[model samples]
Target: MSRIDYSVWDHIEVSDDEDATHPNVNTASLFRWRHQARVERTEAFRKKGAELEEALAESKHELTRAHEKAGELAAGSSKARDDIERLKREEREWEEKVAAHRREEKKTPWNADTLCRGGFSKIAVINDVKTESVGEETETFMSFEKRYEKDVKRFAAMRSWDDSEEYLSDNPHLLCAETFNLLMMMCVDLEVLKKRESLEQTAHQAVVMRFISRLAKALKVDPRACFRRFFSKMKAADQRQLDTFADELECFKEEVRSAAKSPAWKAMDEAQRELEKEEERLEVFESLPEEMQRCFDRKDVRMLQEVIGRMEPAEARAHMKRCVKAGFWVPGAKVDGGDDDGGSDKEEDDA
Candidate 1:
């Protein structure tokens, strides 16, 4: 019986010997470890991909915002350029308007000579009047009226005329053939009252009358005025005379100025002589007593001294006594001492 069970024991012992030689191992465990490592690698790759996608989306959003901001800046720049262009255009237009106005102003008729002398051909019609008898006269009258109206309009425009209606209603004649020339002249001379640098009143009056006389003759109109225009032209003839006189006066003044520099003009010579004499007289007067001051100032002292020195002793004594009586010389002064002997002799004779 023991031999029969020994075969089973030999088989078991053979299996154990084979297991010891191979070493015990499990296929399922090896497979499971390799699968776990592969899963971890896949999960890490997926997470990295998600993070890259998020970063790409954020970059795209920032790019879009930058584009919109750039568009707004371009629009703002365009608007600023348009506004500047408009302002420039407006400035140019204003400058053009200013230039045009200045040109228009320059074209206006302001030549004093042309206005006064009726040089302009432009005319306006007055009411129908006697053409045959007073054609020339009427033209002149109308011209004057137009000139006066122009002046009144100018004054009104300047806001200088207070009584416009009254001035217009009065219809003051600037020149009337019927009135005395002197009256018109007087009106012209009134201009001098308003000015500090006018001709002398008497001289100006004379000049004005002379001018009016000629104007009346030339125009064959009465020299009359409802209102005076200050800067009217003088008659050509009278103006010529005045010009000649003024030229002569200017020449004379020039000569005087030249001669004054040279120390030779007669007036200056006379003035210098007078000044010297006055100085000499003042010196003498200053030395005299207050009571005798007037007499010394009045007399030529050098001449008086010579006269007294040349006089006979008796006459000189008499003169000294008179001077003493007049309070010009004090009785006990040196001037009175010269005649003392004569006075004593006279007193002795009287005794």
Candidate 2:
């Protein structure tokens, strides 16, 4: 058998927002047309089969007429016998054609789902409801997504990418959207944290992302499946290749750190500023109870607000004050409907 070429899916880009729509395309109409087309195709098959059955029924009528004609002829006449046999042969042929049509109807139906499943494969059977090496016992989709998100974020903050990879190797279930997105965000955060010396960290991030993407493309499986493959390949690589990666990583870091105006620094050495902000956020985060801390872990402002809402007025005020002071809530971060707009009311409130 020839190998499949899966290159078409290689460069497909996934939108950051799942429900985002293109203004130029009428997605509703497209879906409607597709559904209509599928219905018509299905009906077409049934209609053809119905027509075949009708013809077969007509042939049976002809056979009955021929038998009646034979009965009216002389009992020993060869002509009457030949007529009956000819009608019987025609009836048999019609019956065979109808049977063949029924078999044709049983062939697999084709559509988007078939294409996605790579055609004619069994409808996926979610066996045991549990993975072999990683993850908790099967839970609802929401619960699993949340659990993986938390774990992935926590793992992404590890000191080294290798450490992060190792964690993922152990907890393979985290090698998914939650993990990949958090990994990307982790790269951004590290870049933000390291104004000047982000080269090595960013390099590592890029390498990890590339490894996952390329392996996924090669294997024609989801990126999650290729996590182990990537690590194995890296582990088996030659020492010279390893040394080159390490030396280049360090050199890139040194080069970035040497830059006069790195993005992290914002044109002036703000090492203390970033550190102070991180310390403040952590302080605020640590002060919260576990339930409240969950909102922070998820970066969910509204949930945090709701948690605060249920508190006594004084308690809410105190929590808000601490959050404000710690820089957990940024001065100009956008809220629902709009952004801060840099107004004096916020300053008054802060003051």
RMSD of each: 48.0, 31.8
Alpha-carbon shift of residue 318 in model 1 (angstroms): 32
TM-score of each: 0.16, 0.30
Candidate 1 off by > 4 Å: 1-237, 266-287, 290-351
Best-matching candidate per lDDT: 2
The C-alpha stretches of model 2 lying farther than 4 A from their native spots are 1-149, 157-166, 195-206, 239-351
Local accuracy of candidate 1 as per-residue lDDT tens digits, 1-351: 364543322322112232232235565665466557655755675444433333333334334434444465766576655545554565455555556655653444322222245565678688876655577765765565545645433322322222432443354442333222222222233332333133223233333333444444433444443122112222233563356435433433343345444534445457756887667655644654453454355644444555555656666566555555444544433343354433423422333
Q: After superposition, how far is residue 171 of candidate 1 from its true place, in Å?
A: 38
lDDT of 2 by residue, 171-257 (tens): 777655444444544444555566434434444654465446645654457776657655654577856336545554554444444
Q: Give the TM-score of candidate 2.
A: 0.30
